[model samples]
Target chain A: MDEKDGCGQDGQSTPGVNIMASMEGRGPSCLNVDKDALAGHEKPGFKLCSYVDSFSETHAGRIPIVKSGLGKEDLFSTVYVRWGIRRHDYKVVPGLYGIGHPDRASEVLVTANFKLTFDHLRRALPHISAWILVLDTKGINVWCAAGKGTFSTRELVKRIEACSLEKIVDHKRVIVPQLGATGVSAADVKKQSGFRVVYGPIRAKDIPAFLKNNRTADKPMRQVTFTLYERFVLTPVELKNALKPAFIAALVLFVVSGVGPGGFSFSGAWERGLLAVLALVTGIFSGGFVTPVLLPYIPFREFAAKGIIAGSVFAILLMVAISSAINGMAGFGALFLFSMAISSFLAMNFTGTTPFTSPSGVEKEMKRFIPVQVVALAVSSGLWIYSAF
Target chain B: MKNLRYLDNVSTLVLDDEKCVGCSLCTEVCPHAVFEMAQNRALIVDLNACMECGACVTNCPSGAISVSPGVG
Candidate 1:
């Protein structure tokens, strides 16, 4: 054990738990793999978070013990991840973990290895002592990982055996997050691993209540809600994803607008390009931000239709405010069409982000709306260029 | 999620009540609140709200629920 490692804040560290398994002065030891082999396989300079302050010696092996409190680094990483920075690399070492001096009889809670999900789970278990069995979902959140098939019954069963959970826990029951139910068949898991799967609440925050209520979640805990705050937080990633393409599209429009009867008027390009860029940015916010925030209040079920309405309203307001700057009716028409088409397309793409949209529903809408979006884009491009002359 | 409703009649979720064992796993696993217990048997109360995530189908011990699971 590393002498520098300190136990939890409470000083109630399990007697048999080791501080850390020394590995050539490396700060933290990876319980799943040896340091040499893990270094060769992992991306260069990439290291799992140093949340394991100590280790619990289990019948399976030495398992990392994570504290319930999150440090500054953990909070900062969560913010960075929310903004879509280094998203794919944000994961923890998937294996068994001890929250608060969990023993053989402590409840075993299964979850994905995405660092954010792991953080949330550990953060909620401050007073509760439990053995967390994290499944490797490749940095994806529980719901998305479940839908994508990474957090499947096979993985759960394999992980159970690999961690020697049968020896670690006295009870033959494991609690999986309800969202993971999409991929994990409880019946199959029970049949394969001799462990009964009891699905926990949809959100980590509700876990304490769930456990208190005899491991049964009420209707509120089971349901997934997309609130205004939830929708607001999700918009940054949407904006970041669309920003690059929107920038390129704006640049092309600005350059093409320079072509006139006077042979590339710099003044004309500057004026018209500003208008085109504003329209594009407005479209992005209207569809990517506004539509999502007002998703429930929006009139239509089809995101494209809702986007068109929102974009048109914003475009009309902007044009009316700057009518004197526009050349003619064609200029106004071009800007309106550009904003509408961009917003509609972006909104349609948001189907992938929503929890309630089905693949069949998205496919149905795409088939009906994609051709319309293409036509609008083509006509708007033609009108935008023609009005320049 | 309660106020927000998607396109009507689009989900492919189907429940075979005859095969249901009244285990209530379907109701517990459904995140959209699509399933409801009626006379101790699970029923699809809100088919339109179903996103076809297949949580109910996977958790149903009796194999009464079936849905073509797919991500949007």
Candidate 2:
């Protein structure tokens, strides 16, 4: 979709303009184009459509309307969309949207423009009809966007005024996700737009219970938990992002491993290079996969430290298993250093994805571990090259 | 915040109790429950629990709170 299509900066949609026109020719009926087909579904109360009808448009802009609950189509599309996002299919047009049959009296829930976040919010509120005020967070999730200031008081006020929200909703309150509180000032929002900001539950799933309990969130609902399942689900994207750098490092190791006293030769080079590659891969598994899965069980409070320990253990096991492949003590030392460095670096990258890490903690970790990792890698590379000669 | 705690003495959160009006907005907005209402003013009950997300600082109408963003 063109960036300006759904809601113009001035809060207006060019009437009758089909925003889904671009998406129409792309695929089959999975697009859910026909309004009649959407409304005629087996799901009686819910409805889905790609384009916003004239009835839902306001002076501010048009709001895309969709079914309240998650259907088979929504789940299927979500999986594919999440995969696409890893490949950088970002830029979902930002604006207000309607979930179920929302009216002015319905609760107004605020969220970021990231499509995955939007989908999660809408899907969570299956039975309740609500107005979702999506801020232009540059397609970032609420937490990170709030930290970046994209989901700030200024953007909230601008979007509210632009959407002419006062005219549509009878209430002056807007429910904001708890994670966005860092960026949104309730007092400032009240002063600027006369709308009171109510902080909601930390997780979308808790919204139903929260709303049912008269918008009062319990301690559990307010808290953010990073369970094993949550950590596991995030590993795929982390692994995908790390692939290019890992490949480059492996390639460098392969070439460097080929150098020997007699100069580069295919026979000895392949054996050494293959061993180096195996060690590197083992490090990646320990750092990227094992550390995250065993985060709570890991002995160290620092992620890098945990990674180093895990990598060292793996390196020791590998060395013991393939002692015959080693040329000298230098080979074992190089392998140990190489694995530890790789694991430490990869585990540090996970700090951003984890809930336990704070920005201050991350900064401290980077300062303490980055130099150590650099020295370790440098020493390991030197040893590998020296051993070859 | 309830069952989990990261490194201690790392959060860059600062609260000026003299300027605080005890609105409890910080307590309400903080996902980690870093603040508590004591007497008429908000107190930093669990300073180490803070993730330094700046939610309390932003919501404080009296400019009583300050946290260096991106410092964790």
Candidate 3:
């Protein structure tokens, strides 16, 4: 442990239990490689790296915890969509293991096997020692896993038998995330595992308080708080994921204008580079960052639609400025094509995160909008070619 | 909207009434208000509006619900 490392507000590595190993295979130490800016303050020793800047988060509250048999750095982390429709596939593993030396009487808290879910749960309860029974939800978060049948009664019962949870903990009560209430039947879990399922807070921060107050979730604890901080922390990964496709498409458009013969020319290709980058970066911020911040208030309802609307507005503004300074319809063509690409890409990606979008809905959007986007690109390219000629 | 006629009317959710224990977890998690409880059982009041997050089908106690997508 680094002496200067910031251990959150409570000076503990996690809220309720000692973080043994994360699902991303992190050991005792964490290094935030692609950590987002939203992570409040970094404790020097905290290691972080993600397929998408997975770390760089800080807790505003506290909970109790103890390290499992797994060390700190070797623990697992990172979220991956392995199968289809963005199903989670990473986790801290399930089963009974030695966390804080096999405390015989420790409370049992169950969570999804998702690495991020495991990390937040461990981080929030850093002060308490307990048994964290990870349910195999294919690396999904507790709430999501619960709704996915991965944390259902049958699985819970099987896991209990497999891990012999009754043999380890003296308590007959198992704390489960309220969000997981979707997938779990408290009574059914009780009938199968002999442990009373107590629903915990929606956010991990309130875990310590809930446990201290006789393990009960208050009305507020049951409420899902999608606060600004929560949404902000997710931006880095989405933005980074979007960067590659944006640049490649922009370069192609610019090169076509510069190197094409007759209807296409390279004379203005260099000038369009900075302009393309500006449109792309602006579109990204509008859809990836700004729209999410204003999600609830954005017009036209659906998350993807809202993002597109935002991107369109920004694109219009960009075109207005370009048209005034450069005086050409090529700028408008580029503006339309770029905005369509950026917005559509961002909107399609919403399938990974939003709670309301269905697989069917996403599929429908792709079928309808993809053709429009392709035609838009074709038209824009044609326009550029004609102007060059 | 072009090739798909049921895009606005089809739901991927299926309820195995035999497995359902009448828990309202599905109703609470669905933001679009696709389900409602009736006679200690969940009824899809607005099947066309379901987002298909699998919250209900996955969370059912008796394993009552099954979901598949169709343009319908």
> By DockQ, who's the top model here?
1
How well does each candidate superpose onto the true structure, as a TM-score?
0.87, 0.85, 0.67
Q: Best-fitting candidate, measured by TM-score? A: 1
Say what the interface RMSD of candidate 2 is.
Answer: 2.0
- Poorly placed runs, candidate 2 (over 4 Å): A1-33, A37-62, A71-77, A80-87, B1-3, B69-72
Writing each residue's lDDT as its tens digit, candidate 1 over B1-72 gives 867777787788889989999999888899998889989998888889989888888788888888774444
Residue-wise C-alpha lDDT for candidate 2, range A1-389, written one tens digit per residue: 23333322212322212222223342223233444434424366754444332235544555667544333434556676544444244435676777657887788999998767876786577567788889999888899899899999999999998888987788999999999998998999999999999999999989889888998888878777888888887887777777889899888877888888888877667889889998898889889988888788877778899899888988898899888988888888998899888888888888888866778888888899999999999899889878776
Any idea how many clashes model 2 has?
A: 4
Predicted candidate 3 versus true structure: per-residue lDDT over A323-362, tens digit per residue? 7544367756766666756765675575556544567766
The per-residue C-alpha lDDT of model 3 at residue A280 equals: 73
Of the candidates numbered 1 and 2, which has the greater TM-score value? 1
Candidate 1 interface RMSD after superposing interface residues: 1.9
Top-lDDT structure, candidate number = 1
**Model 2 - which docking category?**
medium
Candidate 1 wrong stretches, greater than 4 Å:
A1-48, A262-267, B69-72
lDDT of 2 at A369: 97
Rank all candidate structures by their TM-score, best first, as comma-separated numbers.
1, 2, 3
Q: Sorted on lDDT, highest at the top, how do the candidates line up? A: 1, 2, 3
DockQ-best of 2 and 3: 2
Give the interface RMSD of each candidate: 1.9, 2.0, 7.6
Steric overlap count per candidate: 0, 4, 65
